[model samples]
Target: MAMLPVYILAGICLSYIILLLSLLYGWRNLKNNPRFVSPFETGFSIIIPFRNEQLHLPGLFDSLKNLKYPKNKFEILLINDSSEDDSEKLVQEFRKMHADLSIELLQNQRESISAKKDAIKVGIDKSRFEYIVTTDADCKVPENWLQGFDNYIESQDSDLIAAPVIFVEVHPEDPLFRKFDLIDFMSLQATTIGSFGLRKPFICNAANLCFKKKAFQVVGGYKQSGNYAGGDDVFLLQKFKEHKRKIDFVRSNNMIVTTSAQKDLRSFIQQRLRWAAKSAGYDDSFARFAALTVFLMNAALIIGLVLCLFDASYLQWLMIAFLIKFNLDFMLIYKAAVFFDRKASMRSYALSSIAYPLFSSGISLTSLFVGFKWKGRGYRK
Candidate 1:
């Protein structure tokens, strides 16, 4: 029985090593293969779904105005998901100022529990272009965002494209909480890109995801997946994958989208809980395995710490476990940080690593039983 813990620890270490290798493999594959931009000919319908985003709408509008793509080639469809704030008014004001742009504001026709999915469906139904690109109202895209996507679409015969999204640095004097969010988010982005490299793509943020209108129709446009409030992006990706469609990750720097991190710990936890809640509904076996592996690895670390209190001799094993996990995690995240140009955030990695096991384990447990609030709404799993 004494050897049981040792065996479990060995298993986790082996799992971490395999995961690390997978991420490294994915990163190297991505770096070696370069995507070149070609003539922009694909027309896009940009979907911006919102609920009480009055504070961040201006940044998105500014980015939209600065888009380098031809105004006639793409249109913006702003879907209002029953916001009590002045989000509608702000969009109206922005629309008046940019008359040359083909922008329209529409109300979300809620048909299910997930209003965001419903909003996206409405936007797709109203979209006139061949391609559908979805982004969050709180995000800002690069000036060449559409052009990059256009080039990729025109260059390849892909049905869905997953691009990168990062957290915007507020200031140099950002707090530890913000730094924690940055590192945590980068790890997710790294996993996303790495999963694609492994040819087992499971995660993609809707903040910068694009798909074809016909593909969306073929998958029934979130008809069944709308039962959950979250996963509007990942669930749709799974649908595309189920059909064996050509889905590629756009790793170009010019295609990266940026959004602000949650300001406070409560909101951050809530956000993570919302994200974790979607795990139960994932149909992809690789995604479930990856998520379970990560959760168990963190849980084992926390358990090892508790076992140390019973026997001081257990401390050695705990240290080994932490070192293995830490080094492997840092390697994957470092590759991601370099790609995202946020290597400076690694300063807080040591401290964040200590706190992450507990945070992740707690979120994983809490999400199974408790509900979470998002965008001024409460949801129960």
Candidate 2:
């Protein structure tokens, strides 16, 4: 009976280790060797949803201007979700300044609780292209962004494709907070590709997603997930999976999109809470299992540490568990860092590892009961 806690602690650590190992295998196996395709053919509708993003719009606008794909092959659709800022004016100016590029500014028709989902659906309805791509106003796409998707579409009969998103390269001189955010985000990116490599993708970022407009329609769009305020990407991914639509990950670094990290801790916590609130809507067994395992592993680590203070024997068990999680986590994130070209960010890994349990566990627990604010709106789970 005294060893019961030891057994449970070991069990949780083992489960976490197994999960990371499988993901590592998957991340290694997934590859994208860009095919030399002549004359780009796939037409795309780039959908961006915004609310009070005037500060970030210019970067995205500049990136859009630098795209290597044919202007006629893709049209930009910016959906305004009650932006009380100059976001709308900036888009209108960009459109007028670059009349050669196809850009449309439209107001979001709020038919559902999820404003971003509704914004995306509105863009899809107005899009003249067969493929719909979604990204945030704050994200800057690489010049080859659209081209990469085009080439992938030409090579595979994929119904939906998810690419990569990373924060702009963080220098060692930068604040530790930014470095912490980068590594944390990279972990997610690693998990994303790893899951894809396993052929059971459960998470994708809307900031860098592409899908067939027809497939979205067939999946009935985000209507089922409308009650939630977020998950415009995840819920759609679930619907596509249920219908057995072919989904894939774009595994090229050149195709990555870059977005800025949160400016402060308060904003960062809010962002995490918004992300966690949507987990209640996840129906994918693997997603639920993955979320549960991660949460329990973090929670157990914290609990084990507390137990060690009360009983000296518990310290040994906690060390073994922490070592198992630490090494495996570093292995996964290291691979992801190399892929995203942000290996410098790993310098903070040691400290971040110590802080992650508390951070992740708190966010998971708080999200279950607390309401969070995002894009100037409040949401409760």
Candidate 3:
């Protein structure tokens, strides 16, 4: 009985220290990547893939109309990913409404299980410009989105550029569980951009990622990550990393693309699990290290929870366990929120701290057992 309490406390203490170190690492990167204010000027083909995205296009159209870049310098390419819905017609209708917007609607020819990747591949075929800026149909881009990309591309020689992606909460009354999920995603985006600033980092989001048309051809794009369900971001990131090619992370707030948070818990888990499954195939050591850090942090929390059940001696230990967990996570998420400009979500950090470890572990485990389904297709890891 005496040894039980000591063991639990020791485990929790160890977990806290690791998390604090991770947080410190994250905070240091945040400090290094101060925001830039200049506008982007590169002529780009903004390629967007959609499937049943009718609900979100109004906001996207508004953003498109609102962009500050010269209307002629950018063209919008919307690839209909074989949606049964009237997604194509909607884009066409919008095009007719705004004759000067330079919008083109293309049909997504299905070549694989993942509709998104194939849609992107098709978009590449249809693009007439040298530079490509890819964003999700659901995202609400900043007015200066293309201008930021153009400015950065001209000033920098990098073939690939990854931008910041942040989540916006539409429903204020959202449950803590949903908000909990958002906090985790915020830390991820923070680390992704920070890694670029820190040097030797491997993290990116497809929602707001961009690259030259030549870069995709050089790396072979989704060809490397085709067997898997997701990772249009990381797999391409690895290819760029291999060439020792220059890929810059656009940290400016103007470059930030706001996307919607998952509306419910079930869809959220499935989405995360699909992401975790790709970790097994990741070739980059930096991405693997980041993955390992998250895994170990969650593993430590799980062990502590398991001990709390039967060990009466865990009474004092549980108190220490949770305190260490909460504080360590707070440091990282706080920096993330500040960088992403969503500091209000930090209030959700408490529940996120408790749920994140288990949520991560569950996704990892689920990925191992069952193949996940997305857009009416199933894929095996």
Each candidate: what lDDT?
0.89, 0.91, 0.76
- The TM-scores, one per candidate, come to 0.97, 0.98, 0.89
Residue range 65-126, candidate 2, lDDT tens digits = 99988988999999999999999999999999999999999989989788888899889999
Relative to the true structure, candidate 1 reaches a TM of 0.97
Candidate 2 clash total? 0
lDDT tens string, model 3, 295-379? 7656766775677687755656666766776776677678778877778888767766777778787788788888776655567
Error of 2 at 343 (Å): 0.9
lDDT of 2 at 349: 97
Per-candidate Cα RMSD to the true structure, in Å, reads 1.3, 1.2, 2.8
List, residue by residue over 292-322, the lDDT tens digit for candidate 1.
7889889998898888888778788889989
Ten-residue segment with the worst summed lDDT in candidate 3?
Answer: 30-39
Q: Model 3 residue 123 lDDT? A: 81
The superposed Cα distance between candidate 2 and the true structure at residue 332, in angstroms, equals: 0.3
Clashes of 3: 6
Best by lDDT: 2
Q: Against the hidden true structure, what lDDT does model 1 obtain?
A: 0.89
Residue ranges of candidate 1 with Cα displaced over 4 Å: 32-36, 170-172
